[model samples]
Target chain A: LAKTTQPISMDSYEGQEVNITCSHNNIATNDYITWYQQFPSQGPRFIIQGYKTKVTNEVASLFIPADRKSSTLSLPRVSLSDTAVYYCLVGVPFSSGSARQLTFGSGTQLTVLP
Target chain B: DAGVTQSPTHLIKTRGQQVTLRCSPKSGHDTVSWYQQALGQGPQFIFQYYEEEERQRGNFPDRFSGHQFPNYSSELNVNALLLGDSALYLCASSGGTSGSSEQYFGPGTRLTVT
Candidate 1:
């Protein structure tokens, strides 16, 4: 399992683009960088995932460099609803028995101000 | 289709007692994973179940056991609960046993221990 470190908290204004960067220096060869959004009292929701380069979806975009040591999650046009904690995870998807668990770090708390 | 569903949205238990949390996976998902999230912190992986067997586990103790039924539903059982066990229990479901399958999480069960 790879350990990830991210900002503890961030503040952004509504309608702005928010980028949260996560560092995983020990990422494995088969590991994938995944980002999740979590609201209070609710479970974490998958935002985007990327192995290398970049991946985009309706909700967010994930950019990974060639080194795969770090990745950034970009949320466009942030709203008050986008104020939540974001988690960055690096892991292999259950290909092996030991790689099945999803390890979450302290996560980055993004507060979208009005 | 219905996403992951957890029962007893909230539970209250006393120390030294036992409690169980249930979860039904997504429509076509075959794997279920459990996690514990403390207040103001990120989630901690407990274990994952696939094909009605425990495929992987985290640093949780033996007291934190789980069972996956034939229908792909799961139950998390904790015995001799301590005050620290009070947190939100999350259940996530994914499609298969390989690849980077995205996981869907439930609303989570808030367990309060006194």
Candidate 2:
């Protein structure tokens, strides 16, 4: 499993764009980068995932450089409700008779101020 | 479609006692995985179940075990629990090919061991 390092916490204002970066220097070739957002008392929600380059979705964008050692999760026009803990995970996809499990990092706590 | 659901949103147990937590996967998902989330830390994989068998397990002790029913629902059983077992137990489900599949999570059961 690849160990990921990210900021403990961050603060951002409503309407601002937020970017949380995760470093996984030991990422494997088959590992995929995934981001999840977790709010208090709720389960973590998938935000975005990517293997390389940039992948954008309605909720967020994931930017993975060629080296795959690090990835950035970008949230656009953040709102107060966007305040949550964001986890970065690196893992291989599951295959027949194989359990590809995801290992979560401590995560980056983002506080969106009104 | 309903998302993954867990039972007894909260639970309290004592050391040496046994506890069981249940999970219903999201509609259309057939694989289930369990995790333990300690305070101030990230979620740790406990084990994963597929095809009614234990497909993979984490580094947790045998005290932590689980069963997956034919319906795809699962149960996590902790025997002779300890105070350190007090944490949020999360259940995640996914379907499709293993290598690049996305997982969906439930709200999780908060277990407090005394």
Candidate 3:
């Protein structure tokens, strides 16, 4: 299983861009890095995913360096709704070896203030 | 179409009791996965069911079991619940190995074991 490490907590202001980094040194060769945001009593919602380089979506951008050892989730112009726990997960393509069995480490709790 | 749905939004059980949580997968999804989320920690994968069979399981004990129905609905059953079992139980649905790997999660059922 691939292990991930991330900051336990982060503080950001409302209108500022927040970049949260996660490190997964033992990631598999076919693994893709995925991020999820979870509010208090709700299931995690998908944010962004990328294998390498940068993938931009309407919600966030995923930046994975060439090394593939680390990735960053950048949320632009964050609002109070962005305050939640962010989880970084690594997995193979659907139905491949260990595809849906994701191991989530303690994610980074980001608190956006006014 | 409806997204993934979980029943019993909140449950309170005593030690040594048993509890069952249910989930209904999103439309066109055939895979169901279970997770346990403790307070202040990330969600932990418990198991995945595809085609009404246990395809993959996490490091949890045998006390944690699940079943998937032909309609793509799933159930998580826990026997002899302990105080440590107090956490949010999450259910996720996906298109299985044949389709995209993007999994959609439900609102989750909060389980409090006292």
Q: What is the DockQ of each candidate?
A: 0.61, 0.60, 0.62
Q: How accurate is candidate 2 locally (lDDT)?
A: 0.90
What local lDDT does model 3 show for residue B60? 96
Per-residue alpha-carbon lDDT of candidate 2 for residues B8-110, written as tens digits (9 for 90 to 100): 8999998999999999988777899999999878889999998889999999999999999989999999999999999999999987443337888999999
Rank ordering of all candidates by DockQ, starting from the highest = 3, 1, 2
Task: After superposing candidate 3 on the true structure, give the runs of residues whose Cα lies further than 4 Å from its correct spot.
Answer: A96-99, B96-98
Per-residue lDDT over B9-40 for candidate 3, one digit per residue giving the tens place of the 0 to 100 score: 99999999999999998888888999999988
Report the poorest 10 consecutive residues by lDDT, candidate 2 chain B. Answer: B94-103
Q: Please, what are the lDDT tens digits per residue for candidate 3 over residues A3-114?
A: 8999999999999999999999998899999999989889999888899999999999999999999999999999999999999998775652233676788899999999
What digit string (tens of lDDT, one per residue) describes model 2 on residues A1-114? 989999999999999999999999999998888899998777888888899999999999999999989999999999999999999998886543467687888899999999
- Docking tier of model 2: it is medium
- Residue pairs with clashing backbones, model 3: none
Interface root-mean-square deviation (Å) of every model = 2.4, 2.3, 2.2
lDDT accuracy of residue A69 in candidate 3: 95
- Report, in order, each candidate's fnat: 0.62, 0.55, 0.60
TM-score of each: 0.95, 0.95, 0.95
- Residue-wise lDDT of candidate 1 within A1-114, one digit each (tens)? 799999999999999999999999999999999899999999999888889998998888889999999999999999999999999999975432333788899999999999
Ten-residue region with minimum lDDT total, candidate 1 chain A: A92-101
